[model samples]
Target: MSMFEKPSQAEQELKWAKIWFKQFSHFHKRGGKANWDFSPDDVILFLRSKRDQRMPAWKRMKILKGLLVYRRFEQELPIDPFSFIVEKMKEIVANERAKQDGYDTIEDVVGVIDPTEPDAIQQFRRALRKDGMRLQTERSYVGKVKAFMADRGLRCLADFASVRASDVEAHLTDLAVDGNVAASTQNTAFHGLLKFFTLVLKRDMGPIEAIRASKGKQVPTVMSTREVASVFEGLEGVHLTIAQLLYGCGMRISEAIRLRVKDIDFDNHLIEIHGAKGGKSRLVPLPDELVEPLQRFVESRRALHEHDIANGTASVWLPYALHRKYPSAHREFRWQYLFASHRLSRDPRTGERHRHHIHYETFPRHLKVAVDSAGIDKHVTSHTFRHCFATHLLWSGTDIRTVQELLGHSDVKTTMIYTHVMNRPGVRIVSPLDRLSEATGRQPAGKSYQEGRIAYAAG
Candidate 1:
C-alpha cells in the first residue's frame, strides 16, 4: 500500500484513534456510561459535558482527536466508546474489577433493591426473607417472581388480585417454549410463583392446565475410579484437599465452600452440614484419609484468621440474627470460613471488610486445568467428584439407606439414582450370549431346543 492509495474509512479511523489513545487518554479520571447509548449526537453531548471538567491540555487534545473521528463516523458511531480509546479503557476495566472484588455479601449482589420492581414483588421478597430462605434460594425465587409480575404487568399489590390462573400458565408455557428453559428451571419458576400467589397475594394458584416441561430423570455423570485418581493426581495443595472432601463426604460444591471452622470434628471423625438443601442438618463421616491433611489445612486457616484479627478485618458472615444474639460471633474463629479467600472484601451491608471463602469459580477453573493436563477426556467438574462418591459407595455394597443418610438426601428415592448409575454388570441378569461363551459352547444357528438346553439353563 503506497501513501497515494486511499485507505478505507474504517481503517483510517481505527489507525487515528489508536495513535491518540496510546499517546494520550488516561490523563483524567472520570466515569462513562456502563453501556454506551450509541447515538452520535448524544455521544457528542456527553463529550461536551466533560469540557467543564478540569483536565490537562494533552488530555483535551486527545479528546479533540477522538472527536474528529467520532464526527466522521457520526452517522454510525460505534457502540463502544473504548474501541476508539483503547488506552483509556484499562482504568474503566480496573474500576469494574475493584467493584466486584469489594463485593463480599450475597445480599449486595443477589439482594438488590430495584426501585423499578413492583410493590407485590417487593412484598414477595420480604416474605422470602421472613420465611428464612437461603440467600441463593431467595435470589432465585425473587427473580422468578419479578419476571412473572412483569409478564402480567402487576405493578401494585392490588394488581396481583387481578392475576388469573391462565396468566400463570401462559408464563410457564413461554418459559418452556420461548425461553427454552429446562424442566428443573421451569419447575423452580412455578414453585416461586406458587409461593408468591399463595403467601403474598393470599390466593390459591388454581390448576395450571398448560403443557408442562418434560421432567425426565437425568443420570448424573460419574467418574470411574481410575478417572477420579487421575483428577486427584493432577491437583495438589488446597485444591487437592477440597476435591478429596467433595469425593470423600459426597458434599456439594456449595456445601464444601460454606464449611466453617466448627463444622469439622476431627476427634469424632464427623462433619456436620448445617442448613443443607431443604434447610436440613445432617452429619457425615470425615474420611480417615483426609483427617491429617484437613487438620493441617485448618491450622493454616487459623494462622490466616490471626493475621486478619491483628489487622482488624477478621469478621465472617453470620446467618440470620446470630450476629444480633452473639454480637461478637462475627469476629469469632468458630464462625470463620475454613476455605477463606486470600483477598479481603468489603461487606456491602455492614461495611465491615473481611475475608470470604475461596471464590466458588476458582475450584472448577483449576480442576479443568488439572483434567486437561492429566489427558482424561470425559467431561469432569468439581461436582463429578460428589457423583463419584455416591456411585462408588453403592458399588462397594454400601447400604442404600446409609448412603442416603451420608448424602443428606431427604428421600431414599433421590439417592436411588446412584444405583442406576453404578458399574454393576454382574448384578444385572446375564445375557444368554455371555452365558454361552462361559459354558464352553457356541450357539448353533440350526440347533434344536435339546442342543441348547445346557447353555439356556446356565444363563
Candidate 2:
C-alpha cells in the first residue's frame, strides 16, 4: 500500500494478523515448539492460557478477530476453526460492557433474541417466576446461571443443549479451587445450574461429583440492652420505628419493609408477617411499647395515602396476579405500605406507576449514621437488630421453640445459632481469675495488685 493512499481493509487486517501471530509465536515457543506451524488444539490452549491470565475481554476479542481474519483471508483455510470462538469472544465482550454499564439482568446480558428463538435465560426466568420465587431469589439464580454459561463459553441457546453434568462439575470445581468463593455462594450456583438443566432444559443432570467450597462457622452479632438503647437514642422517626420492629418483632429488614396495613392486627395485638424467608408466614406479639407510637405512625400514613389517592397515584404493589384479581385492591388504604416510598416510581416489570416500599438502602444508611453517633464499636447493620432480638429473648428466659416460632425460622436447629451468643444467667461460669481473687481474699487491682495482696494478708 502506498503512503499517500488509504490502506485497503485487507491490508489493515493483515497488519493485525501480524501482531496476533507475534504474540502467538511467543506463546508457542514457551510451550517448547520450534516452528510456526500450529494446530487447532494449540490455538484453543493458547486462548485458555490468556483467560487464566485474566486478560481483558475486549483485548481477547481483538486477538481472536485478528486470528479469524488471518485464517479466512491470508492462510485461505478451507474451514474456519476460529469462527465460533470469535463469536463467543464477541458475546463475552458485550457482556463485560453491559455489566460495566450496570445492566446485570440476564435479558440485558443477552440483548433482544428473536421471539421465535429458544432462549434458555428467558425460559429459566419464567420457570422461576411460575414457581413463585421471590424477586431477589430470581435475580440471584439468573445471575448464577449466566456466570455458568460465561464460564463454559456457551453464548447461544443451542450451546446449552450440549451441557453435561461433567461440565457443571468442572465449573463448580473451578469456583471452589480457583475462585475460592464462599460455600453458600457455591451451593447457590450449583442449585441454579441444576434447576436450569432439569426444569428449563428438561435434561437430567446426573449426580455431580465436584469439589465443594469450604464452610466456616460464623456467630451472629448481638447487642446488649444498654447498647441497643444508645443506638435507638441516635435514631428517630421512621428509621427508629423500623429498627424497633426488627428488634421487637424479630422481623427481617425485608419483612418489615414489605409490611402492608392489614398485616398489623391492633385488635389482636399481633403483627402478622407474611411471605417471610422460605415463603412462610407467622404471627409475632406486638410490643406494648410500640403500640401507641405505631398508632400515631399509622394515622400519619393514612393521611399520606389519602393525599396520594386525591392525586390519582394511590396504587401500591400487590404480589402475583392480585392486581388482576382485585382491580381496586391496590388503591385501598389497607393495601398501602406502612413504610412507603416518598415518591411514586414505575415498576420495572409492569411499567406502571406505584408507590413501592422505601429503598432497601435508606434504612441501612440511617442505621450507620446512628451507629456512629452512638459510639458502637462492633459492626452493625439492620439485621443486627434481629440478632439482638433473638439473643436478648433467650437471655430473658424465653423458650427456644417460642423464639423459633416468633422469628419464623423453619427449624429449631436454625434458631439454635442464637444460643451460642446468648448470655443466659443459668449458664454463667465464673472466670478463673475471679475465682483466684476470691480464694486469695483480695480483689485484682490494675496497678496495685501486689499492694492489695499485701493489705489482704495484713488484714
Candidate 3:
C-alpha cells in the first residue's frame, strides 16, 4: 500500500468486519466466517454503526479487532497494525482487573508522609514550583529525596540529616552501579538534596560537594552558518521567521514561544522579554529584517482577535488583573499574538481557552522536517539555535560581555564557554601552545601583539 493512500470505504469495512467476526469465533475453527461470503460493504456499515462504548465494551471491541486480523492472516491478506492494537487491548483489560484485585502494586500510591502538612516535602515542592522553581530542578530534587529515603526506608520528616555522609555516598554509588545514571545526573540530584537539607530542613550538611562528580565531557552542539542557512531555507513560510527570531534574538525557545504581540517595540527596535528565568524582565535589540513580518502578522491577528472574542474564545493574557486595570487590552491588536496557534490553548494556571502562542511541540516537528530537507547529518534541536547564536556572535568578534547581555547570562564566566567555539585564545588573545613556546624561548614563538595594538588604536 502507498504510504499516503486513503483506503476506500469497502476495503475498510471488510478489514474491520473480519476483526469483529474473529473475536466471537473459536481460534481452532474457521472463526465463524466459514459459512458466509465476506463483503467489504457489510463490514463498513457494521463498523460505522458501532456504538460509543464504556471501558469494558471498549475491551470487547479490542478483542473483535484482534480476531479480524487472525482470520486475515489465515486467508493470507495484508497485515495491518490495527490487529496488533486489539491484542494490546486484551492485555490492558487483564492488567486493569489485576489492579482492582490488588494483585499488583503502583508507585507513589500511599504511605508517604502527608503532603498536606505545612512543611512537608511535597508541600514545599508544590510551593516552590508555583513560586516558579524550574521543572528540571524540581524533578531532580524529588528523585534524590525518594532515592535517599527509600534506601534507608525512612518516610518521616524526622529522618532528615540522621543519615550520615556514608549513606549519601552509598546512594550515589548505587545510582552509578545499579541505575547507571550519569555522573552529571547524579551531581544534579546531589545538589537538589543538598539544597533541601541545608536550606529547608535547616541541617548542617557541611561541604555539599563532598560526594563530587567527575568532570563531564559534553560539548555544545552548534550549526555552522551554511547549515543554519540551509535549515532556514528548507523550512516553508513563517516558521522560518519564528526560527529567525529564536536564533537572531538569542532567546530561549520557551521565551520565544511565550512571546506576545505587545512585547515588540517597533519605535525603539527593542523586544521586551518579560518574566524570563527569574521573574525578571530584560530587553534585546529586535532585528530590522523582522519589522514587516511583525506588522503583517499584527494586522491578520487583529482580525482573528475580533472573530475569537465574538466566539468567546479570546481569553488574553493580561496577567495579574491587568485586564481589569486596562479594560480593553484583551481586545486590542497590540496585545494579541504575532504567531498564534492554529488551535486555541487553555492557560495551565487558569482553565480558560484563549488564543495563545504556538505549542512548543509544533515548532519542533517543523524543525525536524526542515532538518531532513536541509540534509543536516548532525542531531539538531530547537535550543541548538540559541547555542548557534552565541557561537556565531563570538566567531564574528563580538565582545563576550555583549553576547552575555543578549543571551541574558548573569555571569561573564558562563559566556567564556563560546571561546571554545571561536578556537581563539580567549579575551587575552593568548594561547596555551604559544605560552609553552614562549616559556622555552623557541623561535620567538608567539605572534606579535603589534597589529592588535594598532587595530585597537584604529577602533
Candidates in order have lDDT scores of: 0.73, 0.80, 0.66
Please list all clashing residue pairs in model 2, or write none if there are none.
Answer: none
lDDT per residue for candidate 1 within 73-130, as digits (tens), equals 5434443444444333323333333343343332332344455767777677756644
Which should have the higher lDDT, number 1 or number 2? Answer: 2
Evaluated at residue 62, the lDDT of candidate 1 is 53
> Which model scores highest in lDDT?
2
Instruction: Please give, for residues 17-104, the per-residue lDDT of candidate 2 as tens digits.
Output: 7778678868777543333445667677878888899988788777777766666666666435555665566567756655554455
Instruction: Kindly list the per-residue Cα lDDT of model 3 for residues 1-459, writing each as its tens digit.
Output: 221124574467566756567633343244576544344444333433442334363545554554455446555554353444444544455455434434343221111434453344665464334333555566667677776777877776766647765576677767767777776777766666666664456453543223333556567888888999999987766678789888889888878877787898899999998767766678899899888887787778778887887887776666534565577777677777677887877654345567778777878899999999989989999888988899888887799999999988899988787767545334455678777777988654124477667789999
Error of 3 at 178 (Å): 3.9
Residue 280 in candidate 2, Cα distance off native in Å: 1.3
Candidate 2, poorest ten consecutive residues by summed lDDT: 105-114
- Each candidate structure's TM-score, on Cα atoms with residue i matched to residue i, is 0.66, 0.69, 0.56
Question: Would you list the rank order by TM-score, best first?
Answer: 2, 1, 3
lDDT ranking, best first: 2, 1, 3
